[model samples]
Target chain A: MKGKTIIKRYPALLIQGGRTQKVEDWVAVEGSYELYLNDTLVDTIVVSPTDLEAHALGYLVTEGFLKPEEVTGVEQQGDQIFVRTATKKIIPRKAAHQNVIYRRREWGEIPVVSSTLEVSPALIIQCAQQIPEHSESWKKTGGIHCSVLFDQEGRVIKAAEDIGRWNTVDKIVGYALLHRIPLTKKILGCSGRQPEGMVLKAARAQIPIVVTKAAVIDRGIEVAERLGVTLIGFAREDRFTIYAHPERVRVAFSPHLR
Target chain B: MKGKTIIKRYPALLIQGGRTQKVEDWVAVEGSYELYLNDTLVDTIVVSPTDLEAHALGYLVTEGFLKPEEVTGVEQQGDQIFVRTATKKIIPRKAAHQNVIYRRREWGEIPVVSSTLEVSPALIIQCAQQIPEHSESWKKTGGIHCSVLFDQEGRVIKAAEDIGRWNTVDKIVGYALLHRIPLTKKILGCSGRQPEGMVLKAARAQIPIVVTKAAVIDRGIEVAERLGVTLIGFAREDRFTIYAHPERVRVAFSPHLR
Candidate 1:
């Protein structure tokens, strides 16, 4: 797998209080990857050097560079991702550098996710617990953020980790797109803050539910509500906080339990 | 304060085990701000709504768009930051959409920082512990990353927080640049992973020591060593690991303390 090639153990001096000792430590690989839409290089990203295929595809989709179905095949060569597409089209003007955050593609292009999945407080916590089990790179470096796409039954379908939280989410999104998985039918659980960017990714993919152990920001709640997605944060153990579109997540109602 | 203008308090469904209820939660604000230089829109960034001046100036300096001192005044209107610079000499053709990560300036432009600051293990952990005290947004939302520029004595000089780790670093660097603070003697401590990008920021400013409460990736360490920086990671209450250039840090020898 590409993972083993992306992690390395190096000697480090550890200090606890007044003591110091040398030990070998695992640190995730971080590098810059140049992505190309055919021979035309489109962008470069500094990310964990793993899951190059998903990263390239997901980046194109999230950044409004390409659609998943239009991309024929993704091939990787070291720190580059070469994307083969159905037909060559025009690339828009380099946006005003200041407004590149939003692409010209209208948010209306995103489908309203229509998944029938119900997430309980217990289920939210379950997905988080399963992350460490699947994220070997995270266990080694603790420098990576992991994203998992869980099936309708709350079972882990696919997981990807990267040094950048955005990269991790992009990888998972790419994974889902590459495999032709029904995006609306899955839940995305992550190990990074569910900020506006993360919520936007979920909304763009039409993923119905987004869960994280980290807290959600004000804009995250706004986007989740606008896009009709359920955003839950501070999901630890059996405790969680739902910020928006709670109707999408079905937890047993028992006021007496409080 | 711009912070109060951006942050919104909303009711969240808090769940503990089987109990569910609503409580008002404080969440950090996330917004996209378009930045302009002399009315020429230069770049866009998704960040916390506070510290617009630092965000704009830091971005310009870090991206090699303009030196920090060349900027005259920074004005903000909603999500847009208008940068007034001394002159509008040239605006480079926008880099290819795919390769925007790197500006025209090569990595070689970064000066090898040669600060004479010697950090101790106890000092690194001390900086990490102090971060929570200064980060109000993080205390409320836990969705923001904090970065503090510290003097050699392990005292906090200035702190900045944003939704993106890169923004926080850029802000701190901008602060140093705008005020003409000597960079070589300062240490940048952050609440994010030390990746290649983070190290590159420190190197660009010629900051000698970069410390974090998280882990440093392989390339981060590589760049730090090459740039003559001391990189510390996994810094906690009384423990820390030094990845590169240990000679820049001094810990007293006392095997008995182990």
Candidate 2:
């Protein structure tokens, strides 16, 4: 049987004083592609052609499929990507299993590391307050995911919008990688649930602090605790709970900044 | 400078239908497990441990890092996952070129052969209308993604919700895999953008029909066109655009279904 396909545009809908209006729209096209290596199918990915090469490389590395040095050249002709490997025989073994093993043997068994920063109720409140204002797409389409990068001062630095939560994080990571931004210094603030994958992405980027206004799954907490990455969730006004790595968030003795 | 971590949960205030409610939210959890190949480190993935083995296997296959038969055994202890491979040497050489190669090669190329199915505008409207009613979490927290599976009659069979769009689809796919459900006769209705990843997932599952109420990107269209999958987008009450395989969507001349 065959599959079906459709195309549509995203219009910036504005609601002012209960009146809804279309501001602008952009034509968005979508499709799937299967990736091949040396005439053998490797994997499949979904993305835009605008930055196909970078996406391929980043996805492979992040997923532990390929290393940087092993690739001699990457060429794209039409829709097919040919990756030249320095090794004559690419190991038929899958890299994803290796990643799982590495996580278990090295970092998985480590005791949950304690953080130094002490989070305050006020900080969580402040972060939650910032979400509604920043989520322009949500207000427009009632669809879309958002990832925001913030400094220690709780100010937004870079915000990315996507249809998927993981994709938004990946885009931010990709953006950070392109600009040579120091990821460790930033806190990842997202409007999506903090799952294991979300924490993993932050960990891969070496981001220490992850804050969200949504619920955190158990696996996400477990990963964060193991990675020494602080995981915080349920950001609202004047109240919060610490899951793991509580030391990094400094709680003010008084309401005023010291 | 050493990275800092902050973990916390917050009380959230929800605003729906001009009503305000408060809930305790826990977002981030630390979960870490490593996989080992004969005491060697290969890769790592952060995901919910509920289906660690399946996730590991699926990850390996989807990432093009390992084949199913190449894996000998998969064991999960607590939060850690260990996957043993038959091959002794496994090295990933494409780590550095991850993003670039993936995007360019996959997105730029369209499939050569594909199948398409035609859907009625009324059915599309019904699917769109049903989405909001099925989204419980979104109605509560306004933060979640949904994927619904429907039979040819446009009756929804199952609906899955998740913090990540991919996860929702993965859960549905995993469910189908477990139940031995054939996807060739169903339509995948999503509340997210039709990306190459989403389309590839449907293709991998051999699903024949994909319908979305959101915008479609260029690559998504290309993939559906090539895979012979019917792609439909902007599935609203009165209108939709078909990108490929239009022959399958049988339209009746009469307004009534006979």
Candidate 3:
């Protein structure tokens, strides 16, 4: 881990209560990582310095460029990761349709996840609250995003942090792929807002539930609903809002009946 | 205005206080916008579906794809904006260098903003606090980002909201360009974190100061300092942190010499 370079202190002028003071503040490092497939540049992502390998692999997978099994080898040289896949999956440059929000690889097909993984509301809130404690960079700089993957039994499979929320998800997915951990039974929790891109990452990974400590946009809910992913937002403290696929939440008791 | 579709109500299951309730919640709309320069594809950006003309023009200028003067005509057709420029400034596909973070157009030149515009710390705080009140979508959905452009005298030039921070900056810049308002003396206030990409937008537009109610990553500060832009982060309530070019912040009184 590049812990030393991840959070560096910088001189700053702080204004508080109508007064100014010079202070040194710890700031998160934002760096770029390049992904290469068979020596061809796939894309460049902005992320924290840590977990470059996981980020690269996960980005390729979650972005639907490469399936996990298609990867034959992975190598990291400096800020770039060169991966040899079974076949070169060249990412398309244009929008699948004019309405594609992100620079999508292909809007060819939307994968439907049928994981059927169920979790209680308590577990969802617990994981959402744990993001702050798990995020080391966020603790120091109050910047960067944290993403955690949990097993069906609420065990921490892996946790990752990055300057970009998408990078954090990509890191988590990459870690699972590297360790050969099955993502079908995992629940993904993020500390950033759930946009269509973020939800699509969890859906592509076949993670059943996505919990966030922030809001979810309209398209995210639409995608989550169509893809059979359980989308939960505002997941902080003792509450969370389930935007789609509420069946997998497994509410044990109904207060409405009483 | 797509006001009806901007904030849509979705049925959600709210889990709170160890119980669940069915409720309808407001969610901000996230749509994809494609920018075509002289019938050629420039890029597709994810944003809230409003002020798209400003977004298209702003995106073109801020991303260094086209300068303000180069833009001759802009027409909106559904989700796509067809732009005719004085010159076909095709954005380069490759990274200018190996270490480029975002999918930059070109890393060829770093423009140094020489605008000596200064502002009081109180005005910065006031603008930072005013973001919530000025943001209509945020007031309803809490899922959008707000940005405002202010002149050196602290007058509001434009205020915009979007699902992406970069879009907000683009909107502000586009608005300035279309209205023939110069950005050299403008202060850009955002309700999002300051990253290298965000700072570069301000620099590219010649905006002297960038303020945010969030943290400034290390790369953001580095870029801001190199490009001669004032970066103020965590500008909320009565406090703010000046990460780069603190000289632009004209603090009349300092307790340090006392």
Candidate 4:
């Protein structure tokens, strides 16, 4: 493992009607891990190595670098990780070279799958409310991105946290893949705003609903709309805005249920 | 024009000693424009279309979708832009498609350029402070990204403001290209953290110095180090962290400069 360091800070917390309290003693760790391919270095990513295997696999697949089955083995030794793949073609060495040249040879464009799940404003609010509860690391360190998987009943089945937002999502997806969970029935909830890359990753994973506490950028909304995915933004406790795929949300005003 | 709207808000100002004050009556205009290539709709980006030609050319180059010289003609029609390329082949219809398939076909690896100019910490601080003075729109709407160009004498020559950080940088670069400004002697001052994309853009422009008021990610630092570019982060008035190219910073014992 690489030399890890904890970052501590005190943040002012506001409680009901404007009462403010200062909370200190929060802790978070930061570190970097270099992923090698059969002893040859491929890429380096900044993340919590709690689920190192999942992070390696998911990052490769999402970044258009590697496929799931292409990864033959993943081994972590000290601070370095070895990712063995079946292909003999090596990824470029220099960062700029790797970005511009080898990016084409390694991966293909991700396909966007349409989602059928109807999400409601209330569900989006619930998703937002549930995000904080799932963020164990953030509550402690005030630094971390969280990804939660929720079923149709609004119950969170799995959640993961990491220093990087993409890593967090990758962990959740990796966990689902490991457990053989049906991702199509789940809603992915995040604390950060939905960017185009994040939306693309979700679409690639075939997740039906993506709910976030922050606003969705124009490009993200457009991509989600094009992919027929339901995107909910500004998902506060009592209100949310449905950017696209509004048909998935079923709103019923029945007195009997109340 | 697609329903022009001016947004006015009160932004919290972080002044000296962490004291906050509400600055009211800040105004900003929000609009979205669609870019087309050879009559085929390509993409829509949300930005102020004041410099339509520069925005179009820069977006294509930065996105790795097209080269500057590859563009045959660029025409704007009522907020809609049409870019004609020399080749008859259409790149792709969607961003995902372009990212996956067409991205690698057009561009190769970015060239790494060695820097000759040494940038100092004091100079980086001066650059950051100079960023605010050049943000004319931010003084109005408090919602624009500023890109400042500084010479060896630490004089600000070109400054551009846009809603997108990349756009702001592109505007400065476009201005430099048009005005025949020697980029090797210039430093780029930005308000946001360094991302891989931002670093790549700077490298492509061959700018020697990149100073930011925000933190730099590990990948950004690594890229800067590999490219031999001077990257200064956390640029406060009297202190800043030199991530890479530390040799560029000349420390002076004079108390007047410190």
* Top-TM-score candidate index: 3
**B42-80, model 3: which lDDT tens digit per residue?**
665444344455445544442334445677777778878
Q: Write model 1 residue lDDT over B8-76, tens digit each, in one string.
A: 443333222223334443322334556666776665544434445544554444233454456677778
lDDT for each of the candidates?
Answer: 0.59, 0.52, 0.61, 0.55
**How big a share of the true inter-chain contacts is recovered in candidate 1?**
0.08
Report the lDDT tens digits of candidate 2 across residue range B1-258.
111111123232222222333433222211233544444544443322233454444344323355445767766665455667777645443331121111222333332333344565566567766766787555643445677888777888877665445545655654554355767777888876665556765665567777777755444555676676777665665555455455555443221111
Model 4 fnat?
0.00
Q: Write the per-residue lDDT of candidate 4 for residues B1-258, one digit (tens) a residue.
A: 533232323221222222222222222222345678777776654332244444454445434466445777777788787878879536555431222101111113555656678755556677888888875445543334567888987899887654345445655664565356767878988875564546656776778888887655444555676776677665667655555665566644221111
**Residue range A11-37, candidate 1, lDDT tens digits:** 333222223334443322334556677
Q: How many backbone collisions does model 1 have?
A: 8
The alpha-carbon RMSD over the true interface for every model, in angstroms, is: 19.5, 17.8, 20.5, 21.8
Q: Would candidate 1 be rated incorrect, acceptable, medium or high by CAPRI criteria?
A: incorrect
Candidate 3 segments whose C-alpha is farther than 4 A from its true place: A1-101, A104-108, A252-258, B1-101, B104-108, B252-258
Q: Once superposed on the true structure, which residue ranges of model 4 sit more than 4 Å away at CA?
A: A1-126, A129-146, A152-175, A191-206, A226-228, A234-240, A245-258, B1-126, B129-147, B152-171, B191-206, B235-240, B247-258
TM-score of the candidate numbered 1?
Answer: 0.60
| TM-score per model over all chains | 0.60, 0.48, 0.61, 0.45
Model 2: per-residue Cα lDDT at residue A226: 76
